[model samples]
Target: MLNRISLRQMEYFVATAKHGSIATASAQIHISSPSISAAIAHIEAELSVQLFVRHPSKGLGLTAIGTLVLQQCEDVLSQSSRLYEIAAESSAAIQGSLRVGSFQSLTAMIAPEVIFGFSRAFDRVELQMVEGDQEVLMNKLRALEIDLAITYDLHQGDDIEFECLATLPPYVLVGEVHPMAQLRTITLEELAPQPLVLLDLPMSRDYFTSLFAKAGLTPNIVARSSSTEVVRSMVANGIGYALFNIRPKSNLSLDGKRTVRVRLAGENRPMLLGLATYKAMKQSRLTRVFMERCRAYISDQYIPGMSSSAFFDRYVSGS
Candidate 1:
């Protein structure tokens, strides 16, 4: 009888899929390239399905079946790491590695409160955090690199589950000396004529632009940047007014320039801040406890962040 598929094969397959090529996977996992290739070939022969499309010049691409298989392999590896934790749970102590990911734009203000606080509470858990854009975070979630992700609920599907912790309403950001800076509330119609500094990230950009469309006005966008701080600094430097949902703890820009946060008026729907996890994936005990910490921190922190400044308009009339 043919030898059964091995755990080592699954590990090699997962590494290969994550790194995109045998050579790169070998380098990452400290395995020989030929060994990795042989392991993948044996699995393909056993399963009778092509896991990856060979692109000599370009890198490996997953076949449709391979995409599904990758999820299984990742889950297996993730669970293997958690096995120690599960075994240790008999001692009534929650101690293990907790890997996490989050949106890059949200790291500064969020990391200290959530990630740091969690670490303090769970003195035994080893926490790992990786910051990336929305696409990168989603990819990591699918690949099981993170136990769970703290991110905006911009996209949701059957493949993932998002639990909303807070709602951030969109608002206008302006320079400290701008004419509208002192206003308690300003409508999109009035702000549309001014030069705009767009944050210009994928889903976020679409959401901000859609606000103008709903108001039946066209924005005169003059400057755009993918970096959140770049857009904020531009606004602080009088480049243009920008729209944002998250309110920083301070009004100062990266370079110490002051910016004003004005509450937006009209029918603006809030963006949800939430935790995203893969559907059907097993949650570790540490993950469950960390999730509770996340919920509690956001419960207290979200409202305060919104209420601390002019960024969110919870009380302004006609908002």
Candidate 2:
């Protein structure tokens, strides 16, 4: 019976052959030199072939048979790499299920497009979206109940990693006829005296409170609500101006007229739309591919003044 050869032996053999030294090959492959030497020795013993001519001063030299074996080893290794890549591509392309958690505001805005893009690219992927506030979403992420999360930069601990995708400056929304609507921007101090309708959510409230503290001012709260739409409706009806991160697509006008969106005068703190994933969680092949697609899609669509075509070409080409 022919002697059986393991993939590891072939890999070590090929690396040693290509580099001309076991030390260099070990460094390249992140393995110890002793291990590489032992693997080659074991393979030689099994095959009963003197593959390498090791000299006292000169490094390893391949014998005639070793040279032929090395050529075949290269072919085998190349095929193995291709097989892995094909399997990964198939896994990425397969339709499966992904459970995602996202904030309420994102569900109506970015989440839909992200889901659509993922579905279009990987038609076999069935998307399940769970909508909640930041706290709820973060809790689910910590518990591993969701595969991925889209939310604000909560500055969660080291266990969770946040990647900011887009940044939108803080703005104030008010009725078109409101006095402040005529101005392009109003200072935090200037708006300090007006009645404010707070979002009442923990994240939003904390962010605004910190902003107010930084500005050395305080807002007089007349009403509070968790619903962004409700806040917009109240602002449109002249209840009060509400500070928000992004300009709303709808409710720009309450009753057929455009409402007002004014950029705050002071340093505009950006609200970041980002992705969050657990640092410790082992990412599956499908998950990694989907994440890559998400990043590519976001960069293509959201990045301004950059040529998406050129960027994609450079990225895919690995240049």
Separately for all candidates shown, the number of backbone clashes (residues 3 or more apart, or on different chains) is 0, 5
lDDT of 2 by residue, 1-319 (tens): 5434555567878999888899999899875565567567756777788899988887899999898888987887788667545654785545577877877866666665665656665656777788888888888888888877877886567788888765666777778789988777778888888989888886778887677888777888899999877778788888899888754445454356446777676675777777888877776666666665555434312322222222222322335
lDDT at 83, model 2:
57
Query: What residue pairs clash in candidate 2, if any at all?
Result: 95-124, 95-125, 96-124, 96-125, 252-259
Which lDDT tens digits does candidate 1 get at residues 1-319?
6545555668889999988988899899875665567668767887899999978787999999999988988887688557544645643546789888878888877787678766775577789999987777888889999989988877656799898876777888889899988788898889888999999887788889889898788999998999999999999999999999887766889999998877787779888888999987888877877776576456312322234222133333324
Model 1 Cα shift for residue 25 (angstroms): 54
| Number of backbone clashes in candidate 2 | 5
Output the number of the lDDT-best candidate: 1
- The reply for model 1, stretches above 4 Å from the true place, is 1-93, 300-319
Name the candidate that leads on TM-score: 1
The TM-score values for the models, in the order shown, are 0.66, 0.64
